[model samples]
Target: MTFTGVVPKRRLGPGGPEVPVFALGSWNTWDRMAPPERRALMGRAVEVGAAFFDVAYYNMGPHAEASRTDLLFGETLRELGLARTDYQLCGKLWLWEYPEAGFAEQMRVSLDRIGAGRGGPESFETVVVGDFMGEIDIAQVVRDVQAEIDRGSFASWGVNNWPAEALQLALDTAAAERLTPPSFAQLKYGLVRRSMAEGEFYGGWCADGTLALQASDSFEGGILVGKLAPARKIGADVGGIRERIVAAYPEVERVATDFGATPAQLGLAFCLANPATANVLFGASRVAQLDDNLGAIGVLERVGPDAIRAATAGLWLDRDVRADGVWAP
Candidate 1:
């Protein structure tokens, strides 16, 4: 259970830093727990070498709430005496707020919220532009991010849920302007969600070293955990994507049994198996869930390339053609 194994170190992108393959997903989970339990979970995560984490301001919930997630994370680190150098932290701009405040302000707010010097620096190893949903001026954003990089605020930057065309334009502009382009992309990818993996965006990243593809929602928001059957039996409203995922569960279960893993683990392995995927991000509400999912790192090599593909292919046949094409819920 020592994460010191080679599993922890992964090249984030072509010339990006060697970050851990799995960074703890800190959405609302951090603030939901009691302070004592929160400290315990952080200790366990560090023990297992899951020192890397990702959090954002807007994702910390309403401004009126208790301590925001960023502040809570920082407090826990200080309480546990974990130095900023002990972990690598990533902060992202929420999809809705990125455009409103622009790059610099968005990043400044996130860092301020996370408090100071809790993750090796008061800054991020990289910060993500949460989503590209507007008439974006890609060149301008890149310059703003480069300014942060120059000031040593963040080492690199990337996009999330951005369209293929927009990503390309940004890259092309960076090349012409001789600025650093995005080093990675964060998007939804899983057994039941294949839009990012099947489309031109993923294909292009796979073909080049300029950007690495990192998967989020690799379980389709827990539908691939294979527990929906009970929920359905109890008349739970498991419709839409949940319905599709439940329908696909049997296939996933069958494959998982072959490898002695749960459907969730198999799903995670399936994502990590993809050539374009440099990293996979997943949620863990408790310490045990964190242990189970981090265990997917081991499952990666045991499952191998061919078995992982055969197990996951054809499950979500229409995933790439979905109307939005970017699966985020």
Candidate 2:
């Protein structure tokens, strides 16, 4: 529970747990790490108080469904003999196929799948539930999740990749019903993809202190860090700007060198520099990468956030990719 020198802890929302500014995410990347390496990486995380984890369950995604991260994580935890209290967890309640799977059923089944009931964190500290592309009854979403919270399934909830309008409706709906509003908003946030979190709509909520910003996919599947030809599966290219992102790598590197930081450190610092970012979630498959990425904390202190943003302002990479109708599977 004793976190290292990551200054300024932020609370997730009202009644939510305060957490470190960075979190470890395992989407399709967990299995690639061998048992010994995974144990070492997690152990380091614990030692440094960087144990906040994003373990979103993949009930229905092409790339993520194929990735058995929950199974792998549970197996690894048992191997390391880590108790439930060793780390804080943020789970996801997928709305990709809502009603058919509902929040209650999803929580029970997925937590069991993750080995929670038998021997894991019994309930997540928080859960993010969104991705409402089509017709979504926001009231029902809140009601169902409220029920789950009462059942001790999760302490608080948040939105994920949801439109600003939908997120507002959820907040409004929760207020009207005297229920719990979402604590945070998880989005495709990073250097290249800043439209959602920093743009007018979502930014307004963040500015007004309505929702905490939890950034994900900040590395663009390693493309931003020079993994231009990643052989493994990555998250959805919401804007289909993989080439543009890859091309920007040199610029990223140049700016990083100028700042006396590595590209990866600079990227993490950029996300962390934003006052709204409660945490930046990234996937690292190696212990060295884990340690290296933590150097971003120093980058934020040395070069600072505004200078980093100004340095990369010419990139012109802040457009909304989904709204532009440019998507790649």
Candidate 3:
């Protein structure tokens, strides 16, 4: 399928300007494969108009063991001769360490992987603090993020997987301190999952001029892909994700049939269909997988109001009311 003409773009947030509808997710792809495989996938994603790539310092494993993934991502982009400005790069701070200094080092390590060392120019325009996981001190995290910005390490910063209240608190603290508030927030949203997008998180951020970047928008572990059947044992590789999905959405099969689109495509489109979602993050393991997902941008554009309503109805298992809530059945 040749994607002719330009892929449509949407604003990063109100008054934040526009970016491509689909963004490439590097978490599983970078961790599960070797450098060459990851590089090829990155190139293919770029060809299909997946101009944004999401990376994080701890994407590989616990601690910094997987830092190489980010390095390989940059190397591949450079090898493809794509100008840094031609693509948008978004990465996160692992935040495993607390206090401002440890957090600062985490950002520094992330920048180094993306080729933005002390004197080098930054290839990334956006940096996010990961998960928050309801554990970190929101105020301190915000302060550390601002320190990086002050040093010219990043242009913008935001939160990921944080609850609506936590996000508001961070924004409020930044206001009191006169620091730069986050410009984006990353959350999970898909055909079966709408609460985060439709609930307080979306409303709060939208009102605050912050963009919502939807990660795992496809409902990671392939629940939205319809590959794993209820009562069946998932392969050892994806067992953890599979178990979570089966537990949460026992009726996934019934819901999958209603969408007409494959689980993967529907999941991707669900996020794209929302006007509030700035971009949908897709995880592809191979070049072919990347190509297949890029087609979703077209599928999303074709989705009308009825399709969205039908897909959301009876598809979601649960909804998170709090900003830092986790939705595992």
Q: Give the local distance difference test score of model 2.
A: 0.79
Residue range 80-103, candidate 1, lDDT tens digits: 877767778777855454456666
Q: Write the per-residue lDDT of candidate 3 for residues 1-329, one digit (tens) a residue.
A: 64554656776653233667777766545666776887777766666566787876654224344446666666666666776666787767755445543656776677677666433337456766765443668887788778887876666776665666677788899899988787766666665455565666565565455665554545544655654552332112211233555555545445434645555555666677666677777766777666656666666667764676565666654343343434222
Runs of candidate 1 with Cα error greater than 4 angstroms are: 1-6, 59-67, 95-100, 117-120, 227-240, 320-329
Q: Point to the candidate with the largest lDDT.
A: 2
Q: Which stretches of candidate 2 lie over 4 Å from their true place?
A: 1-8, 61-66, 320-329
Give residue 148's error in model 1 in angstroms: 1.4
- For candidate 2, write residues 5-81 as lDDT tens digits: 64346787566789877788878766778888888888888777788888856747443455578778877777788
Q: Candidate 1, after superposition: displacement of residue 328 in Å?
A: 7.3
Query: TM-score order of candidates, best first?
Result: 2, 1, 3
